[model samples]
Target: MRKLLLLLVCPLLLSAQTPADQILAKAKAYHDPQDIWPTLETTFTFKETRPDGPDRSTIIILDNGISYMKINRNDEEVYEVNGEVAEVLKGDKDKARALVLRNYYLYLWGLPMKLYDKSTPEISLAEDEKVGDKLCKVLRVVYEEDTWYFYIDDFSGRMLQYKFYKDEATGKGELITLEDEIMVDGIKIPQERSWYTLPEMKYLGTDILEEVD
Candidate 1:
């Protein structure tokens, strides 16, 4: 009886791990069809829509870790950064804004693909969830700084939306919807992201990928 119970429990434990692995594999394939994160070279235009003000646009060129970003709001030529060295080619630039812009672009552009990186958070399967009317497979990612929940489409395996908590214990978080998709170098990327405060569902701004190369 003891041996039989052990045998039964082993398969159950193994089967439990299978779903998360399968979900991750499908998501990776959908986002990075060619597996081109390491050598990804592309240029795209990012536009931010504000609730109280006019829209802002920036042209961003990313070649792996090196990037060149140009903002239309200012006369500051082009801000270029290669590894640790950063500089402006034409006019006065705000270093603080440049840093934030660099992280903002890189993080958004490298989605489900970047989640697979070793330095990123550890990903595990969470209870199944629903985003609006769509049923999704929930993925719980625990990073060093915060916890994030990702909702992947049940049928398509594409990432539909994600949420991050400001205070995990209190369940205070924000949800971001990934809407629209475009292909860049065979990889499918979310073209627009709309953010909202969780629970209350207050509307934030949207980031639009206007152009891509």
Candidate 2:
């Protein structure tokens, strides 16, 4: 009886020995089919809609190395990120703040898409969890002195959810959750993001992206 049990479990164990690093490589190859991610500065438009209101604007932006972003909504200015205030031509403080928030939100939620090339310490297989009905292998990641939890589907190896625990400096810091599915260049990507902050509040947003040349 004992021998039979060992025989039954041996293959399952060996087949499931996928580390987080290996899974990440496979995921990048599968998810980023069209290579739309920005490696350098680029400007493209986006249509943003909220339940309370809807708006269409030209999302002019720069993504220099290190994720520096400068976004202009139509002829009006609304966003900037990691940019020097002296360099900006806009004088509206409200627009600057909006730009900064936009940049921060976009950058945080748009990751795993951006985590395409980064490699860090690889951890052994942790556990398995289900994000939807799909079974995923949960992996723990520590980057930038911050800890994060990720779930990647077993077969497809695509990242399903990325949860980041904010550092202690901001006593009111919180957790970031990225979810949902968005199709980009025919590839499904993360579309919904729930930014859970301290004081028991959350900023929930969704990005329904359509790929345009």
Candidate 3:
């Protein structure tokens, strides 16, 4: 009798979650099946290519459990942040940019999982969007001043692209298309990200993940 009651309540519990919750769960399962991101400690080595500049190489070390991060560009120190304080070791000494990059790296690398962060105010199911030839389920996340849309493959639950708008009404923002994946520490992370202007689709650049440690 107890086993029958448990089986009956399981489906009901799952169905009670909103569409946004379900989609996020699927996406998270694909990206971080082991659920190890909260205490994740890893190093990322990547190359950045842009039409306007020469290719650049960057290395980033992150330990999410302690909120610690360090970034290096071309073998030179860019910045390091531990907890709330950030320091720029060389170059311009821009603490502001360092802090921003801290958030930027963590958020981008942490993907659908980061969407569940407490700092994230809202996530909702949005109309489906086509990424290239494949149709994807869309998730809209609202921030204080910006709105972001993430396109996830319906069947595989992998993130295909994401766009953020400063002006939601005018759709003035950038679109980032994800390609390929790198498996590191049991996590599937997008290998390449191509950036373009929203409506114009002006080509910007691509960030390619080369290796991880």
lDDT of 2: 0.58
Cα TM-score per model: 0.81, 0.56, 0.93
Better of 1 and 2 by lDDT: 1
Model 1, span 87-151: residue lDDT tens: 65656665665666676677767888777777776578999988878889988888766788889
Q: Write the per-residue lDDT of candidate 3 for residues 73-119, one digit (tens) a residue.
A: 88655898999898988777688888888888889878978997888
Pick the lDDT winner. 3
The lDDT, on a scale of 0 to 1, for candidate 1 is 0.78
Better of 1 and 3 by lDDT: 3
Alpha carbon lDDT at 125, candidate 1 = 90
lDDT of each prediction vs. the true structure? 0.78, 0.58, 0.89
Error of 3 at 110 (Å): 1.4
Which runs of model 1 end up more than 4 angstroms from their true locations?
Answer: 1-19, 65-78, 88-97
Question: Best TM-score goes to which candidate?
Answer: 3
lDDT of 2 at 62: 54
Candidate 2: residue 49 Cα off by (Å): 7.6
